[model samples]
Target chain A: MFFFALIVKPLVLFILGLNKRGQNNLPVKGPAIIAANHNSHLDTLVLMSLFPIAKIHKIRPVAAADYFLRSGFMKWFSTYCIDIIPLDRKNRVNKKALFAECHKALDNGDILILFPEGSRGTPEQMSQLKKGVFHLVKDRDDTQVTPVVLRGLGRALPKGTALFVPFNCDVVIGQPVPAQEKADDFIKLLASRYDNLFQYCVTHQEPEQ
Target chain B: MFNIPQNSLYTMLLVLLFLCIGTITRLVLKAKFPQKDYTELRQRIQSWWWMVAILFFALVFSKTTAIILFALISYLALKEFLSIVPSRPADRRVIFWAYIIIPFQYYWAATSWYGMFIIFIPVYVFLFLPMRMVLVGETKGFIRSAGVLHWAIMLTVFCLSHIAYLLVLEDKNPQAGPIGLVLFLVIMTQLNDVSQYIWGKLFGKHKIIPKVSPNKTWEGFLGGLVTITILSGLVAPILTPLGFAYGLLAGLIISSSGFIGDVVISSVKRDLQIKDSGSLIPGHGGILDRMDSMMFTAPLFFHFLYYVKY
Candidate 1:
């Protein structure tokens, strides 16, 4: 925990040159969930880097079981260094069981990184959001679910691409929407927040002059 | 020059001192505000340890090693500054050229080509960057984009190159060599910032310029100036060729101009409506945020010593 949080994390983020905003909006302590728009594989790195160095270890990003857990070394790296919550992307996703794992994490008072859009894609393109995040926190009043939208990450490392574009990525944090009962409304509200956050990043681009 | 082993011992002692101060502060803060958060103070101390270690090792090695180390720092500073400024699609090629020229700029200093190193960026590259941009035919932001790119080159590469150039100076003082000049400039400039912050919080009544920088106060400015000037005079005898009087003058110059650089960067951030250039360091905003004062102080002190040495 000390080695990864202290040394390895800062070095990786330094090389990537990530530009993040609204980090203060992150709840200092979280029994909460972060629902972000995933772009490149770089999205997870950028998202975690924005966390306060001390509390960064508390974040357990939901990683695909097939990809991250394939090899022994990677399994060790992901589990120990990254501390990801291994959740497979497959048919049905076992809503009741999935809810249990995430609920346990939230119950233990940790932040879980969930890409409600379900998979990585280009920035600013909103995909249909899943209701896993909503279900995890629906009845839990003590938990907070914040919307985080990432821009420029797709250009940084696009889907189905191995090379980096060396772009400056921006992250915007949105206000936590009240968790409503219906999955349909919560997903709809999450999608709109992603759009608003993305719009804010684009419109606020600095002038060269 | 002082014996290399003795110098290393002294530097390690300085590092130990910094560690002590940081640990004591952390403990005191924790005791005083047990309920409040000390995340920032902890991160800051953590960063300071790495920074001191990096620099101590750099100085402990040969001159070539120090030059390479500073070039990397300049590269990081340039990358952070350029990333924040808006750019046109056409400016991409020119930006690449800017990165390419970083190694070139250091190469000149590494080989001690003073004549060309001083003017290449300001004269040749300055002209070349805009000409390259104009060739791209992006009329929307041709002039503005060219100006910003040119300024980034000057600030990040040209200004920082002076530290490398200090190493190239002819050996005239055995008591204090070029590396000492580099250390003195860095240490005094940094101490100026610390004292000002401390003094400002203690005795800052009248704001120097509320519009440009609200925290800068006459009390803080003068307090830092006088304290650092005296300290510079005290340290300069063993650190640089400049004796007490010149060192005092150099300290005054550093504190004042470094203030301008700090405020100017602040205004630029204010105009852009952004805070703290980037997040490279925890508790400290970014590379640019940390280097703002050093960027200004390096070149000024370099030239000041250059003229004095010649």
Candidate 2:
């Protein structure tokens, strides 16, 4: 974890010229959730590289079972290296298994990263956050949610292309929103917060003074 | 094709020692202040290794290889600068031409054509780029656009090419080898920056230009200039044909000129509200951030050598 995060990932991000902003907003020790906007394949790499070892090892991003767990290599990668929770995004998305997986990770006191957009979207402002993420935390009061917005992944490595253009990946991390009572209300809060972060990213083109 | 100069080898050994000391210091500091994050410190140490490795290879390789290496650096730096600045879609064609000019600029240096190499970016590209932009028929912010593109080319290509053009310097003076001159200029300029940072942290009280670069201070600037000048004064004779006095003058000139370049680039990034130029180099911001000081030092050092030793 230390070698990959500290040595390898930074070298890769340095080559691609990824700038991770507002990473300090992430909990140093996890047992929390990182709910971010997803658009590019670079998202997972961005998230993995942003945090140092302690928090990084604890982060298990919720990846689509179909895409991430399908291939044998990806299956081995997801299970061993990335340590993602396999989420069936197809018809009848094993909601129970998803909940059990989230609860299992949270119960073990690990941070779970989720893309509430569910599937990758252009996320011009933000795609509508799905209900599963809201449900994952709504019933649980212990898990803290950090609303994150990842900008520039589209430009860095767009959906259709493998070639990566050099650009800054701005991570706008909002204040941790404690779980709300109603799932819809919680989803709304997350969506609006994600939207606000997106706005801040676009308007604050200049770097922090 | 080359034998590493005594000065360059000495400089490399010194750099290795400095990096080892720096890494040890960071590790000790991290142990002392376990709560504070040393990610930047760690990045700095790693980048120094990368820089040293690159310098070793660039010099060890033939002069042609060194010229090509710098040309690639110029391309990367130019691209990074252009990507950050805003431009219309219509400027795309002219921007393509901007990239094309990079190889041509290096070609002149490779061929040792000093006349065209010196004037290509400033004279030819300066007029041609704006004319090309005008040919695109986009008049909105034309002056601003043209000025930005030309400025980018001049700094990223023209000034940086001077480092590669060091290869051609030996054509005039056998005593001033390309490897030694390059090593001296680069190591001296970088040391100037590092010394400024150290001085600023240790003795910096009053900000020099708080509005443009809040981190810069009077103590840092003056202390760094003295340190770099003295160091360069000692090292220059081993690398070039200059006596001690001229070496000191070169040191002072490089430090003072390097400061201007640093401040100017800082202002640009500040205007753009960016902390670093890019995230290409760890601890350093971008290729621009790493090369900004060179923009001032390379040309000055090149011309100074051309007039005196060459």
Candidate 3:
């Protein structure tokens, strides 16, 4: 928390600026899900920094265990520093156990940040979302799943790139999609919500020659 | 307490006076016309207070601080401009180079390297960026991308950096230092903007450029010109080394160029099909929206002063 407030927040705010809209749509109290498109590693940090520092303890990002836990230092950093709930992406045998931790976090009223696109894709392009977010929210009708679309972070600090060019990124938080009975229906609803929210980003103008 | 310059101190006081006057006028107007919403006016005034305070401290602190402040302004304006304009995916690396140019550009101003500072963007950056873009092997939309990227750098970084370069001027005027020169230019430019808006609202019948900016009128333009010219004639001698005649010329240059800058950005916004560039400032729109006139006025004012005094 000290590290985040001192370093991460300022770096995110000052260097890579976030022009956020619908910040009020983020539930004040949680038992909530913040599902956004994955573009860059900065997406997690940008979203976490959006909340007040006091609520930083209650917010947890669900990340891939295979990637985040590959190195000993990374495991420690992801677990302690970022406070991620590491999900086992390799083995489906422990799927129930993996979801148990997520259920437990929500049961404790912690906000879980999930990237439904599975992993970082092409910069500023949205890939087909996996059904993982749907499975998490399917039974938990009480939990509010907020769809957030992050633009320009991918361009600023996209995957396979260490260099961070300064760019104004947009964080558009939409009204929480109500839990549907079917997984396909839920994913469709979430996808449509993201489509609607993506429109609110900085309107792309044809470069005048 | 900080060994502030006498001229800078007076300018700060004058700015505070204007802020007070604006507040009192708004209060009186709210009282008289209770039905009308003064929310936008109130927001504008509040934002002005913040902008003025930040700018005042930056200019008065030190030359380095002032240069860095303007550099940040250039970064923000460029960010807003880039976010609005569409860029090719291949040009993303080229965009990184664009951001990198800002620091080097300001470094020239900080060191007062006039020879390199003048040609860095137009000559070096203009040639280098396209070559770098060509290396990406994506020729589709190549010309358009190069044009957009270069223009963004020129407008945001190259033009606005002139304000910072003002601080490093080798002038012999004891009464008007480099800081005073900056204060003079900024105050005159902003005052020109305010007076034009007020005049336009009061009696803006003849549309000057209705297609680009519907709100701009000839009456407003002339009213603002006369007001700024007279004010400059009075104020420039105190803040700058210019006499009354040169001051009037400075006023004429700022007012007309400031209008061109405003409409130029307006035309860009119109072409982009957006109302505001970004919602960085409450009433002013974006940093680009606020500094659009400065983009034009800064370079022109610097050259004018350079030719005359420097």
Best by lDDT: 3
- Tell me the tens digit of each residue's lDDT in model 1 across A96-203: 765666778878888989898888744435677887787777778999888998765654455775645344556788778887889899888888777777655521
User: Which of the predicted structures, 1 or 2, would earn the higher TM-score when compared with the native?
Assistant: 1
lDDT of 1 by residue, B85-119 (tens): 77654566677788789899999999999989999
Q: What share of the true interface contacts does each candidate keep?
A: 0.22, 0.11, 0.56
| DockQ measured for candidate 2 | 0.13
lDDT of 3 by residue, B1-310 (tens): 8566687677789789989999999999999999999999999999999999899889777889989999999999998898788887677789989998999999999999999999999999999999999888889898988998999999999999999998998855566677888999899899899999999999999999989999999999999999999999888888888899999999999999998999999999899887888777877777889998998999998899899987
Please state the error at residue A171 of candidate 1 in Å: 4.2
- CAPRI grade, predicted model 1: incorrect
TM-score of chain B of 1: 0.95
Number of the top TM-score candidate: 3
Ranking by lDDT: 3, 2, 1
For model 3, name the residue pairs that clash: none
Each model's backbone clash number: 1, 2, 0
> For candidate 1, what is the TM-score?
0.74
The window of 10 residues in a row where model 2 chain B has the poorest summed lDDT is: B169-178
